[model samples]
Every structure is written in structure tokens, then in C-alpha cells.
Target: MSHALNILKEVFGYPAFRGQQANVIEHLVDGKDCLVLMPTGGGKSLCYQIPALMRKGVAIVVSPLISLMQNQVAALNEAGVDAAVLNSALPVEEAQIVEQKLLAGYYDLLYVAPERLLTKRFLDLIAQIPLALFAIDEAHCVSQWGHDFRPEYRQLNVLHTRFPEVPRIALTATADAVTREEIIERLVLHDAEIFLSSFDRPNINYQIVDKINSKQQLLSFIQHEHLHDAGIVYCLSRKKTEDIAAWLNTHGITALPYHAGMSPHQRALNQEKFLREESIVMVATVAFGMGIDKPDVRFVAHLDMPKSIEGYYQETGRAGRDGQKASAWMVYGLNDVIQQRRMIEESEAQTQFKQIATKKLEAMLALCETNSCRRAYLLDYFGEPVAFTACGNCDICLNPPDSWDATIAVQKALSCVYRTGQQFGAGHLIDILRGNQTIRVVDWEHDRISTFGIGKDLPVKGWRAIFRQLIALGLLTTDSDSYGALCLTEASRAVLKGQKKIFLRQQPEHKKYLHKKQLANDCPILDQGAQQLLDQLRNWRTETARKHGVPAYVIFHDTTLMELVRMNPQTKDELLRVTGVGAHKLDKYGDHLIEILRIA
Candidate 1:
């Protein structure tokens, strides 16, 4: 029983430590370095936060996003911790005041952006203060191989050089073995203990569908599964983000667009609105969602395939952070695959890097096309094996995809590519197989090929699926020299000569679940009495948050408010027993809550 555990219970209001939190905290409190690979909402902040409080002085947190710092500092202050952030967003006078206070030892924790932390002026200022530890959040950004690489983060090795006496902790929600090694090497945490929590997010239902009427499909998903919930819809381009946001708004959903193209003020305002309000969907490119700490995001949908599995995992990890039932829905097609391949080939990265990028793209495709347990495949990608056979929560486990022996169809598709001299891409090959009388097919004389019109029994999408699976299976390769022309690989010869068999998933029918008046019964629901109290509590919270100019979650998370409603505590002592009601919060809101509970 250490003081850290006591602080966790008294300040954070959690009765016990989850998973390896206590171990990580103990290691850090012992003045040692650590690399923590916990899930998004697995209490990574607590590991360093508790140790910082229990140790000598201020804990400096290096974060990538200003919003992340603001959100975290606000939450810490709400929990009765003296925390502040230093970033360019602060005015000159305000920054001077904060600097003076920081020098006077008035703050327990200080959050700063990487660029600001690396400044000579800030470094000199920190030298005068007794420091507790250095917490490098979103540590994967230090690796070039990571999806969200920040070059500024690479310079963080200066921390080890400058503050040799202070301990450091690097934390990330997403990182594979390769990225993990890179974080340790780049951050110079060679002797740090590594804590790799399970990456399994069972509360999020994984659903990947082949693209068909993508906008309609997205609308259907929103209208049915995640209606009236806060979520994020990721797009590939800036223009697409704006278009989709507008479309969603036209259909009676409050939506906003966020991308690098937007002005800084506009992006900040939109993000603030999303965090403060409910049922607002943010349509954005990868420019958003690095350190968004919003806990109530109910879903994350992707209209395009991510460049790699790491990117997909990190993006989807944003949802269900509050441990609520959420959805990770995506729609991809062969076009997305081709476009991603083209982008990779056109990049200026070195040849070896290009090869690595191509392999990652193929891995993402495999996850999409996998008919087995999606969670198992995903966890296996990160080098973690689960004991269970099936996750029972993903789309694949709920409705097993149909598979057909496509030995003959695959051979026909490969032969068509070979006969076309491997000069045509999937479109021309599909045209040749489906006997499309397109001018390109006619000019190439592919209509007279032996494989021509032999696959008319299958539709164009079906043939495309076979070719994509062939590519994924390594039976076919894309020739970048010829602008993505299809080429038969050595493995294709066995399938063509009847020595090998191929299986392909039958194209699933695009079925949309009907919009029910409410979500699934299994999800957290309120009875009529509790619902009335919840409504009143939400109204009070919104007003309180507005007056204080902080996000509603800072005042109290929706989960805490719901607990108040369910318990219907009529007395101040009873209200203190509710979860999330620590001494500070209980004193702040106990009377108000008890009054509302009694009136309801």
C-alpha cells in the first residue's frame, strides 16, 4: 500500500488499479525510465500522473497537440491537481505570468508542445526547477516508420542528455514491435521497462465492407447504429472531408469539417464544438485525431483504406475510449487499393522504404479481406496472440462471410492478365473477362483472347474481387513501371496449371440494418425515471461547463452523471459514494446533484 495507490483512490476515484498500471507507476516512482504501450483509455495518464504527485517536483508532459494539453490540464485541474499548459496559444502576458508561477513552484504538472519544450529559453527555465519526470505522450511519433511521424519528436533525445537525473516515460496507444523498438532507440530509453497492454478493444464492433454507394452506406450506418452519438468520419482528402461534412449536415445531422486546409481558428472552433456538444460528427483527413482525448466518441468510420494497419489501429482506437460500445465501420474497394499503391510509388521515399510501405498496404488489404476473426488477425499483426478462437463481437464473428472455391475463376483472371501481355490493369482485365466492348479492349484485341467472355457468369465486381484477392494472395503483382499494370507472379503459374486451388469470399450483399428508435438493448440504457434525472443533470452540466469555459467532460463525464441518476442519491453523503465523486468534485457538485435527484 503505497501513497500512489492512495492518491489513485482519493484523487482519481478508482477503487483499484487496472492491468499493469500499478506496476508501471511503481517503476516510474522508483526513478526509472519506462515505455508504456497501453490502449487509448487504459489509464496511461495515471501511470505517470500518480508518480509525479508522489515524487519531488513538477512533471513535464511533452504532447504533440495543443488541444490535448488543454484537455488534459483542464481534467487534472478538475480533479484538484494544479496543472497548466504552455504553448503558442497562450498570450504573451499570460505566458509571462505562467512562467513566473512555474518558477515559483506553483504547478504540479506542466504540459508543453515538443517544439516549445525544445526551445532554449524554456529549457533554461526548466533547469532552475526540480523536475519529477518527463512524460512523452504519443511516443510513436518519434519513429519514421510510424503512421503519424513528427520530425520535431525525433529531437527529444535531448531530454536524456539534458536531464540525466530525471526519469522519463514514453506512452502510446498504438505501436507494433518495429515501432516499439524505434521508440526505445530514438528516445534513448534503452534501459526502460516495457509495458505492452493487450490491444484488443472488444467494445468496438469491427465492420469492413466493400465499397458500394459509399455515401448512402455511410448515411445508413450513421442513421442506424450511431444515431444521436458523437463520432468521427475519416476521409482521404481535404475536399472529401468538406463534402461529406456538408452532406451529413444536409441530411439533418450536425457535422463539421476538420483538415489541414482549414484555418487554425476554424479548426480549433470546430473541434471545440465537437467536444462540447453531443451527436456531432467530425469529417476530417488524417490531419485530425492525433491526441484528441474526447472520451465519448461513439464511432469512427473510414471512407478510404488507411495506408497501413498501424494507422487503422490508431485511428479506430479513438473511438470507444470511454469503454462504451462503439463501431469501427469502413468501406474499401480495389480502387482504394490501386490509389494507395499509386501514392506509395509516387512518394520520394527511398527504395527500401517504398518496399516497406507496399508491404504495409498489402497487410491492410489482408485485414479487410479476411473472413476469419478480424480481432485475431489484427492482434496477430502486432505480435500478440489471443487465447480465444473468436472475438464474437466483430462483423466476421457475428455473420461468417461465405467463401467459394474460386480455383477456376482465379485461373481465368490470371490467364486473362497473361494473355493481355501484363500491360493492362484490373479494369482492362475485368473488361476482357466480362467481354465489355470498350474501345480499349477492342483496340488491344483482348476481345478475341481465349479467356474473353468466359467469366460473364460473374459480375464485374465479382471479377474485381477475385483479382484483388489474387494480388493479396501473392499470385499477382502490380507493375509500377507500367502505371499499375497487372502482372502474373510465379505463384500464379500453379493456379493456372490446376496444381493449386484458390478460395475467394463471395461478395457480401450490401445489407443495411433498419433504424430502430433506440440502439441495441444490451447497450447502457436508462429507465424512464433515470432518464428524467439524466436529462436534468446534463442540463446542469452544460450550463456549468459553459460558465467555466471548459468542456462538459471536465466538469463531469457522462458516465458519472449517469451514475448519479441511477443511484438517485438524496443526500450529500450518499452522492459522495457515486463513482467519479472524489473529495473535490463531491464538494463542488454534491449539493446540486442531491437537489436534482430529489426533484426528479
Candidate 2:
């Protein structure tokens, strides 16, 4: 234990382990298998890292992306640890040298993609070396049920069969019960202990608003609050990413587009800019942020709704990773709901898969439309207990929306769907209810239907909200055979028969909570001189990062810099006492930091 604490201070420069990090590390160091569920920036890496250093042989860390491994290896090397990567990104000679060094026991940790790790030649090489442990990062990818599934991850149980005595630890920032079950089954970790932490990021403020002029609303959000702040804006399609990026750039915000459709080189370049530079927004689809190491992202904005609560939680978890204040802002509307359903209906996956996906999508919609505490609902979805119903941190808790009895309105909508031959999508139905005789409605003579104009008292947006709630409530479903036509489900029968009452939440107006309160997560603790000093240090970091060709956060995280600004360390001893400033790092950069502090 003394050895572990000494390494924690001298090697990693942390004063103590956070939450359950020490317990996890001790279990792993004792040659036991375990599974860890901690949120992003919760120090999951240290759970495996210290064990890797303390154990007898090299730790083989399984990662899903080359970029993730590269960044981690860079950071570990900066910490003066002996880390190497074995992936296709390496040149042939370099790969051979890594293999040679592996056999010679020169490396304490090795990062490899799952594909390369599962190869027979690699397994054969491992047989000749003394095994320490296997660290599987992003372990949720092993679940076929996960949004980011990798087929190669399913075959990783071979590690257990081949090296029965090696300790294993699977770590992920997001996973529900189902995904966790699949990961354990697939990874053959039935005997492993489970260490579950609270899946909550208190510093991240969650906000979802009705989508009226998404582009303009997004512009207002950035201009009003997050101007000159680094953030990410996620779109649902490749074209939307491009469109949004171009539009934002034209609006005087520096933005870049990234999707799978872009060329690899262009995508890499954009990603590099987003990481190395400050205040650049990356408009991308879901392809951009699995293992992103940047810890200073001020916001994560979504222009579209993700398909599942897991996906939403994981994406929003990216913000405020430095444990400072950040916002998870999104705009959702009826179109977002329809688009998600249409996607699920159109997928070529099996019926069971579609069923599960639809269920997940329904849960996501519930999150979007809930009037209760967003944080509590999200925590409940992950089976975590929430002591309070209202977290006072989300949009709903801050500005509670009014709810009205929508029973009669819901019945009228269902009757319209039934009378319209169940072949019309939301637009035509909405137009019919609000008494708009579009060409198609008039061509079908549907204006003569009994339910036509029955909902004339409601506005178009109000009717749209009701229909969205109906679909979310399972009272109405999109027919898979037709072109996203609304159809009444078995659950709809209860509402139409007056056996069930429906209530819908109104689209709450943007109360300008952020602007009114000026809720900058990173602002409260900073004064004028401290802010300038932080900026100076950031400028120095950017120059140093550019010279090393690595992300600036890799040198020192924003939280560590904030500590420096707070502590104002003047000597090597004082600087070394700061979190994330290890003995090795102090040896490398302490004198320069002290000189800066002295001058300031």
C-alpha cells in the first residue's frame, strides 16, 4: 500500500485516489479480474495504469482506435512511463522493434487494437512473455447491443482461454444493464467483481429545447453564451454536418465539418484543428468522439436526437470533463422523432433487433419530453438511484413546463390517423387537424372527413407536440410497410375507447437561463489577474504542444492549470505538489513554470 501511495505521488502526482480508484487498483494489483463503470474523466485509466506499473510484466491494453492509443501513449510517455503501441499505424520496422522489445521486457504497457490483438501471431508472441494483466478500455464495444459495436470485440474472450492466470479489467464510461451483461458474457468475466460509480456529471448542465429554426437557435446559443468557447455540435446526417459547419462559418464562428463520408485525411486534419486549437467547433456526426482526450470542451450541442438513452448519455458526458461548468444543449422536434422512427423501421436488421432498437428510441424520447429532473431520469435509466427527484441543474428543473390534459386532443389525432387510411405522415395529419387544405389533402378530398378541422383550436406547433407525445407514449406508431405513415397501436385503442387519459407537456420557451444568470462554468472562480495568468499559461502550452505535435491538454489538463492559477506555486517543491505534476514532469518543466510564476 505504501508503494502504491508513493507511486501515486511520485509517478502520477495525485495526492489521493478518487472515489473507488484505490479499491479497483488494489484488486487488479492482487491479480483479480473486475469490471468498472465510471463516467468520463473519472480517472479510470489510473485504475489500470498503477497496476500495470506495479505488476510483474507488461499490461496489454485493448483500445478501439489508433488515435486513442496514440494519444494515451503520448501522455504516458510524457509521464515518463515505458509505454508502446502495436497497431497498423506503425511502420514495418517500428512494428518489429516493438515486438522485439516486448520479448525483451522493455515496455511496461502495450496498446493494441482489438483486431491485431486477436491475431494468432500476436497470441504466439505473448506466450513467450510473462503476462501482467489485460486492460480493455471502452469495453462497452464488446456488446452487440451497444451503439458503438465492434465485431472484433466479441472474440476477445480468447484472452481468458489462452492466459487463464492473467488478471483482466474491463472499463467503460457508459453502459446499461443489458450492455453490461453482454460485455461480461462476451469477455468471459463471469467471476469478475463489479465496481460501479455514480453515472452523473454534476458540472454538466443538461438542456433540451423545442426545435424552432434550429440553425438560428444554435447561432443565438453560441453567440449569447459560448462565443469564443471551444465546443462540439453534432448533426445526424453527413450533409447536415457540412451544411451546419458552412453556415456557422458564414455566421462568423470558426467551425469544421466531419463525417464518415469525408476523406480520411480531411477528417484527421479537422480533428487535429479541433484538438490543438482553442474555441473551434467541430460539426460532426457520431463518428468523431469515442476516445477524444480534450478535457476543456465547454459545450456539446446536438441538432438531432440520438437513438437511445445510452447514446445520449455518452455523448453529453463529453462536456465539462475537466469538472468545470459546461452545458449539454440540444434542440429536438417532431421531425427528430419521425426521423428516428423511420430509421429504425428502415433498418435491415432482424425483427428482434428492430424491436430492441425501437424500445431504446422510445426511452430516448422519454428523456427529451420529461418534465421532471433530467439528471434523475437519466440516472434511473442506468439503474442508478437518485436521492432527489429534482436536480436543479437541468432545463426542466430550472424552467418547468406546463402540462395539460391532452386526452381529447389525443383521441382526435388518433381518429384522424384512422380516418386518413393510416397512410399519411405527421405533416399531412398536422395540416388536416389545423384545417390547412394542402394540395394532397384536397386531392384526396380528406377535408370532408369527420375528424377534419376537429382540432382547429390548437396551433400547428401545439398539434405537432401532441402527435410527438402520442408516438412517444406508444399510442401511435409509424407503419414500417408504408412511408412513415402514422398508425394507431394497441395502446391507442385504450385512449380512443376512453379507457386511458393522455397528458402532454408543452414546449417550454427558452427562458434564457444561461444568459440571465451568466452561468459560465469556468468563470466563477477566476478573477481578472488570474484569468490573464491562465491565458498566458495557455499560450505557452499551445506553443509547446505545437512543437511536440500533440494536443495541448496532453501536456497538462485544464484542471491542472486551474490548480496552478489557484496555488501560484513559486518553487519546484510547490509545483511538484500540484495534481498532475509528477516528479518526472517537474524535472522536465518545473523550472520553466517556476520562472513564469516568479515573473508574474
Candidate 3:
């Protein structure tokens, strides 16, 4: 057997490694340092995991998230591996126990937070162990230029200085060229093979909707898209997280809130509930989903714009980790752009950091507003070449967007912005277009202009689209603090006074897929009778999974139960023939299936 295959089957219970994991593992196992860039669900863990399992001594993994450390340690224990974690959550005696185990070489893997590793006592204890390799997860945090940066990561260079003989591996699911260079320099990876995997997750369906009653849109999406499946809803603030979580629960969806503000126990309980599939959604700020090892998350919804495309990609990639079909849906508005910019402008980062953040925000905005394939743009940002024009999975790909000659409309919007002295945002501009005699307009005496009501032919939504497209096209600028005030760009001179013709796609009213009917023939077993049986089976499965603290599928797959309901199989032999029902599972679960089928 190949070395990777052996590790996969024996250690990970798989037959093969996915994507570029095998190549990465080989480089690390050969005593070479590596810088690996893979997508979230792209099997990044195994790149270091398999190599760690194969190495001579216990591998020390430096991770940024303490919760993730506990999760990984639990997962490793379930896989029958000797693993332990060092964090503040443990009591002194428990921590001492783990330390003693480390000294006795009792663990095959040790996961530690970067901050925890920097302590003098921990470093002294680590010195006594026969170290195999050093693995740094979320290595992007080492770079000050990267999102999610930790000041403690820069101190990680002491690993190289202190343990010169140990091979090191740094891994992150998101990083651009600038962040990549910073990670290498900050981590002191002077000689490391860089293994970059393709960033495309073809199984994910990408969709972006205009921010219209965003709460309703999110609820509608959760209800209709994949009802009650495990998912995440990322809000940009703590208040939004709490409100959204409460709203979802009141609407009958089991959702929880997670943020750094919550007590550690509460956060742990919520995270544990989500991982155990007792909760269907986790409404969170940026404090969720890093180093989450859960594999069956079915969707990720963003109620606000992320700061960068890399952040968006990494956040969305958390869905569909099992390679099953999933979705990445986002709701964004002009204010999101300004809010993000304001955050960067207020930060203590250098000028280069500000520029990079601004450019990344623009790239993300372009991706959202582009009439082109969303997947293609995302892949291109990760430095992957894409010859395929349309991926047929995203909203833009499935239904072609409509383009309109908006030369007159762009001219009207720009003329209004310029005539109004660039002091208003899209709302006032839209009101002006729709001929609303609001007090702001009368106070500014803007009603006398000829271009004031010329845009009356376009609806408010249409005019908003124009303004968004104008910002994206660089024909307009938004004030960072005042939340999307419309200001003219240099390109505005060309379009405002008819010096140059402008073209813009009409903003779509509702995405076409939202109108699509459920497939008629996909699952014929969803009829009334079968549905009744399915519900009973679901209850049974949920109880069983809860009792065992595993995902529902671990108890019984939906497909298997659906088939049994459809076939109404009365015997073990008949039940065994259904898809996903192996002999052992049939033997264990056969009687339960028969009991449910008898009632059906």
C-alpha cells in the first residue's frame, strides 16, 4: 500500500486523501517544512494530520482557537488516537496530568494555542518531549497584514530558534500573496515547499441578494433553501448575532448565538450543541467556525458583507464539507461597503494594510455585483486559472442577468450626486430619482434641477442598482464614515455630462432560482404517507443521535430511511437491499426499520 493510503485507512478511516493533501503530507513527512494553502473543506487537516501520525514522535500543533483545539482533541480521541490539548479551560491538576503525559510520551498528538505555547513553563515542558514536527494551523494569523492576526503569532519564530532540528508546517485556508509572504517571514519558514490547492468548491451554490428586509430574506432562505439542515449565519456584530439567533428560534428553527462576549461555558455549550447536531444554526460574529471539524454543515449565510474576499471564501467554504451539495448565500448593501472601509480607516494598521484591505473589499464587491460566474471570480482571486466562463452553480450562472443601456440613468445619478455636492447617500439619491419631495430635498432646494425627476422612469430598486453599479464601476465614491454617501469619481466626469456613454446591468428584482419549483421527481417518497413515516423516523434518528452525541446520519441516513418508507420492506433481506443499508447496519437497525415500516 502507498504510505498515504495506509495512513488514510488506518488512521483516518478513509481510502484516500482529497485534493492536494497527499502531496502536502509527503513533503512534510520527508522532513521538509511546508506552507499549505487549501480551502476550508479541502482536506487541509489531513495534510498535517497524516504526516503527524507518521512522524517519529508527538507532533505539536499551534492553533489560534482554543475551542477548536478541544474539538480536534475530542475528534482524535473518537478516532482511537492518543491526543491531548493544553488550554486555560483545564484545571491545574488536569493540566498537570496532560503535562505528565507529555513527559511520558503518552500522546501521539498535542494541540496548543499559540499564546499558551509561548509561556515559559509550557516551553520548558515541550523541551523534554521527543518532538516530531511542528504544525501551525491558521498560519495566516501570524501575518500582521492578514485578517484574524494575533500579536502572539510573531513570537512563534522562537519555535525555529529553539527547535532547529524540528520540521515545521504552516497551514491556512485563506491568504493572498501579501499575507502569504508575511506568514512565511513571520513564522521563519526560510525553506518551505508551498503547496497551493485549487480554491473552488464546485458543490457549493453561490447566491447574492440585494439587502431588502435582510431578516426576512434570511428567514425565507433558511426555511425554503434546505429546511432545518445544519448551517451557520454570520452577522457582522454581536447585537445582530443575538437578535438573529433569537428570531430564528422564535420562528421554530433551533439556533444559537456565539461571540467572544459570551461566557466561555456558554460558548462551549452552544458550540457543542451545534457540533452534536442538536442545533441547526449558529448565528455568530467572526468568532465562529474557525478550526471547526464538523463535516456536514449544509449552508453558510452572511447577513452582512465580510471584510475581504479571502474572508468570504473561507467563511463560505465551511459549508458542504462532506462534499454534498450546499449553498453560500449573502445579503449586502452600499452601507456594508462604507462600514468595512470605516473599520480599516480607524485601525492602527500601516498605510499598506489599509490599501490592501481597500483593494480586497473592492474585489469582494466586484464579485458580488459581477454578472459573471461567482465561482470563477473566487477561483481567480486565489490565483487559479479558470478557462470555464460559467460554473452553472452560482446565481449569475444559472440565470443570465439582464443588461440595460443605463447611459441616461448613470448620467442622472451622477448629475444628482454632483449637483447635490456629493453630500448624500443612495437613499436620498434614490428619493430624488423617484421624485420624493422629502424635507432633505426641499432643504437643499434640489427639486429645481432638470435631472431631478428625469430618473422617474426607474424604480427605487432600479436606481439603487445603478448607484451600486456606479460605485463598482469606479464612477462614484462612498464616504467611509457617513455610510455610503454618494460622491463622484473621475469617471463621473465622463458619464455625468455625456462626455462618455455608460453601460450598466439592470439590478435583478428577485433571483430567478427563488422562483424555481422543487424538482417533481427527485424524491417521490415525500408523499403524505411517506412523509409521516419520515417524521417518525426523524424523531427516532434524532433521539438516537442525541443519545450517542453524533450527527443524525450516524444513526440512520435520510436516504436509507426514505427508501425503507417507500419500499415498505417487511423483512431484513428486503431492507438490506435498500441503498446505504449494509449488512451490519441492517442487522443492528433492521428491527427498528421493520417496526416503522409496519406502521407505514
Each candidate's number of clashing pairs is: 0, 1, 0
Q: Candidate 2 on 238-353: residue-level lDDT in tens?
A: 99999999999999999999999999889989998998899999999999888887898989999999999888888888888888788899999888888899998888989989
Ranking by TM-score: 2, 1, 3
- Candidate RMSDs in Å, in order, are 1.6, 1.4, 4.4
Could you give me the TM-score of model 1 versus the true structure?
A: 0.97
Candidate 2 lDDT: 0.90
Deviation in Å, model 1, residue 464 alpha carbon: 1.6
lDDT per residue as tens, model 1, 59-128 = 9999999999999999999889999999999999999999999999999899999999999999999999
Candidate 3: worst 10 consecutive residues by lDDT?
514-523
Q: After superposition, how far is residue 448 of candidate 1 from its true place, in Å?
A: 1.8
Distance from true location, Cα of 387 in model 2, Å: 0.5
* C-alpha TM-scores of all predictions: 0.97, 0.98, 0.88
- Cα error, candidate 3, residue 405 (Å): 1.6
- For candidate 1, the lDDT comes to 0.88
Which segments of model 1 are wrong by more than 4 Å?
511-519
lDDT of each: 0.88, 0.90, 0.81
